[model samples]
Target: MRNKGPKIIILTASYGNGHLQVANSLYQECIRRGYDNVKICNLYTESHPFISEVTEKLYSKSFTYGKQFYKLFYYGTDFIQNKKMLRWYYQYGFKRLTSLIETEEPDILINTFPINAVPEFRRRTGIVIPTFNIITDYCLHSLWLHDDIDKYYVASNELKAKIHSRGVTESKVVVSGIPIRPSFSQSLDKSMLFDKYQISPKKDLILLIAGAHGVLKNIKETCETLLLKTDHQLAVVCGKNHSLRNEMAQLENKYRDRLHCFGYLERIDELYRIASVMVTKPGGITLTEATATGTPLILYMPVPGQEKENARFFSEKGAALTAKNQEELLNSIDSLLKSKQKQLSLQLSIKKLYLPSSQEMIMTDILKESEKISRMKNHSTIKSQKKKLGS
Candidate 1:
């Protein structure tokens, strides 16, 4: 039986990979559940290309070369949730997005980024579509909070409490966890995956991921440290960073049979399945995926704002270890790799935190609320007709 659900338009921005990953996950699950007319919009790219390019360049530079400026900018804007800025963005996005929305005639709008244009669209067009915000962080930023959002899907109970404290009603918040693709939750035969990847089935696999942009500092040092300090096979993913991939490729001759280098692999889940320990930055989606796979994490040099908070949350839960510099990174990896008991404990902690049904739960709630709204609108139409007839 096909589900009769409302048409959905998921709004996402590509500032980081996390937001787009969440949007894609939701989009895929909606299609699986028989949603016929679902579309995803990269709001920045489609509505404002020039601004998007400029901002993307700045974002990349900040993480790669301007760390101090980025930290200052992130912390400086954290508390200053100005509606004026939001209104400015609203005005700028209005003309481009309004026509698109008008043509799509979507029944619901879901935002994965903190783009505040949705409310403005509703205000300008006088359309009463339900809106949802899936916050892509472990901590709540004030920019994501708006009077117009009907529901919020958060990562944890702590985040739920924090949002509620910010005057959002408890009923409006759902602790659905972060949405990750279904592949991370599936059971895979480790031996089979190892064989397929041509990795040694007996040696412990150490996986290193440097996020989508591949801007992690000292990638060469990290790989060298793992190779020298432990008797493990190494796999590194240099995501979309050709220069970093080239740098890593040069090391293949030195490590020979022990090193596997990849550039922008679509099947990261397979790598996650075979690895016993993963060293990565604490981007929300990556952290969530690691937890889902029950891989122990050594968080390396997380960027200031939300990434720092994510690292703190995971470290406090005993699910991961945080390393501030190169020496600490090597020591953390050595500690985890040496003790199977310690690694299993961390994996158990991650297993406790993982929520595999978050996507399904979110979809269920959305459909139920959509049905209720439809009924209310029908009732109003009937009442108005009776009034016209009597008059």
Candidate 2:
């Protein structure tokens, strides 16, 4: 049975945790479904480490220091697909991806991150392998578009329409909510989570995530404001940010009874399950995870480009609240905490945004497309042999 499964190659980049996290979700689903041949390629890092390293650093800083330039770059390239100069970016990991496809001969390729190389390679090489893009965000960007992409798994109908407006056919889009860990979709023992983390079930839990790189700004002030003004416990996740983790240790000691801090949690969904409110920068995967768990989100100070758009999407949809500064954030949190109806309203709104069992849906769709491509190739092969025999 495993031998019959189509081999999968998921292309992702490590600019931020969102892309790789989506890749991991799909990879795990493939394994669960007995597709043991699935592979995740960190195409950027594997192909050009130096460039990837440079870009990741630049991107991490983009939210804080370089956001204006980032906004321009993100919007400026909205139609780069039609321009001849876009060929330069098409070469980012083009050669390496080509080489890998030749060596692996994968049945299909999935892009968890935007890499122009996929479409460019397919169009240039005329390879017929099924390719799909999992857009791990609420809004659309041109970087994710290419006609050669066989299909797109998008977060919302709005995003699907955006793709349609970009001249991609309506059939090419599926409004599959962004893939997150399956645990989010499963039942969690709330009591077990409380006891395991030594959390006080008595007080409301305010979960603040700084993302994988600790990119959320003003976390210390945000946490302090919640602690001083509210009767809530704090659970701060300072992911991969060692300095922030160190800073949090001091805060943890000061508010030892009410505050807990962690780094790079293996079971983040557990935190999501027990959280009363989630305050963090709006990355699509994180927001999607909160949406899945029905956790109320307060997206704090999203910068320009996708983060802002993601926040805007959820806010406009009434799934979350947007806060522009410390004052606005605390005010939003205060309202949610004090008003049970407000909390319930946000929870209900987020439930509307959830596409049930997102990981399963995306995985099933990928396999379906792969099977179609395999059949097409087999049919073409048979026709070619018949023609030779007739000749």
Candidate 3:
């Protein structure tokens, strides 16, 4: 059934979780602003059940066999000779999603994932409503470049420039950072965060997150070396990796007070809030969140395609330090821990990278556009009524 109030349907995908994170942030901000008719849905689940199932199998394969396969798929985009596949997906995929839009007749539509953006644009023909694409990554992708897309909400000026380089109109891109959880914009008591996690504020705390599927091959060995060779306490978050969580729990028992292990945690913002340093791959969303919380980054084992590029961009800007292997990872961690000056410098760099109010910025843009459309419709209706009375 259609909602009685105005609706804005947010579409996201589950491949890496960044898109979903961006979508959720927009949802919360809209509701806070009294747009209670907003709804969130998984794009693949709703429109393409068979394709979603296949994508899940492919994701598991990449996670288990090797992430290089996923990298290969991302890199394989270079081979596309033209926009043939893009046009096909626009027709088939967008057709499947039209019913929801027709049923709700939303005032605005938001696309948080690139895979969903092109199709959305194609489906929007003859519709007067506004559409916006909130890109959740630092880099632009082929799937994100389309003339029909009205606005592009980007993470950084660098990405905005890159999107323009891909032949998009400069007027269409907005360099608003990726939307993050609203809690990130609020100031939190660091000590309270530490207390909540039962971590000591006196010692430097490190947060280690395995990517969605789990740790890099050398992460376990790296964790052991840090705990044994250095004084910094480590908290490892193995998200959705039951086996890795169990293994880390066994190790934590031996280390006692120094090591903490967690799985599928809800309060990740708290972890970032309390941590002095963070060790993880440079996923766009994770890095953005870490910056929001002012946590220093030690990026390790970045995958070879987009992640590698993300790591380079971060380290060059001094927001993070990169490690080539176990020895280097240990050395980098030790160096950061040993120097109070270095830690302070890193914190200052993180502050420079912060875009704390992106959720507000993106949502505000959407509302302004919707209001403009509403005013235009009202003016057009009055014109028609006047003409009918004169006739």
Candidate 4:
């Protein structure tokens, strides 16, 4: 069922990297599946400048101050969403957003982040298009509540069921999993991957990842502790944080043989493929990538609200474990390194939890919906022409 019409647009924001990451993967998958008529747009930047700057600053603040500031914003949004005053704010926010959507005139819209959902609802007050909200996180928020959304692609059945509980129709929800890149779905031999990185397969591998903005508190201490006591190899990804990378260079030099540090890598899929365990903040994108690669997770210092829910959900499901303090982290690492059986169990659970081809599934549905809309448009046009001729 090939789509033979205008491009389908994927809208995302810079609040977190998860939205853009999912949009890019789906865009790539659309191209791979022979649909080049796909466009990925950062709606925040495309729609409004002042708002985007404020959003970027908020992201930077979260990374610098860590969890408390992030939670503050999250809670603030919750507070606003709970009140009626913000309804006008929401409407004003979407007015400019709708202007951008009208200009794009995309056949179908896939919103990777929730903020973009506002425009969809507002635009549908007088217009309609096939719209889908791809919930990037494992949890849903009030922003995702839109009557105009035709469908929802969510991370898990649990999230889908939860959305249903909130009065969303069950039939409209699809647990297609989070949209991850295709590389995460592939298998790599540990020995081969290690050889490529010049790492030793004999040593246990611990891959630590900071979130999109590289916002983990006490990272320096965490790295020092892991290097001092563990008989394991460590790969630390600093994401977009250049300062952290510069700081870690000295440590990398001291532990050059066992430690690997990277800054904003595009090929994180390879590292995930080889790692025995992943130490990361509980981000939907990172967790999905780890799960896709069948790597067990050691959840660390998650931001409150949605992130906390993600960490708790996956940990309680046995796909991962949460480490509250430094001692628990060290103990968790030691336990995993020594007990291959436990690692194997987590791996099995992660595999069971993952939806391997989620990116493809989501794209397929988007294109299908687009074609349906196009057909309806053509039929309506032809019907109007015939009526005019009869008159």
Best by the lDDT measure = 2
Q: Is candidate 1 or candidate 3 better by lDDT?
A: 1
**Residue 318 local lDDT, model 1:** 93
Instruction: Name the lDDT value of residue 274 in candidate 4.
Output: 81
Ten contiguous residues with the weakest lDDT in model 1: 85-94
lDDT per residue for candidate 2 within 257-361, as digits (tens), equals 999999999889999988889999999988898888899999988988889999999989999999998889888888889888999999999988988777889
Models 1 onward score TM values of 0.93, 0.95, 0.89, 0.89
Model 2 CA lDDT for position 221: 80
Q: How much does candidate 3 score in TM-score?
A: 0.89
lDDT of each: 0.84, 0.89, 0.78, 0.79
Q: Could you tell me the lDDT of residue 167 within candidate 3?
A: 81
How much lDDT does candidate 1 score? 0.84
Which parts of model 2 are misplaced by more than 4 Å?
Answer: 1-4, 79-81, 378-391
**What TM-score would you give candidate 4 relative to the actual structure?**
0.89
Clashes of 3: 0
Least well predicted 10-residue stretch by lDDT in candidate 3: 115-124
As for candidate 4, its clashing pairs are none
Q: After superposition, how far is residue 246 of candidate 2 from its true place, in Å?
A: 0.6
Candidate achieving higher TM-score, 1 or 2: 2
| RMSD of candidate 1 to true structure, Å | 2.5
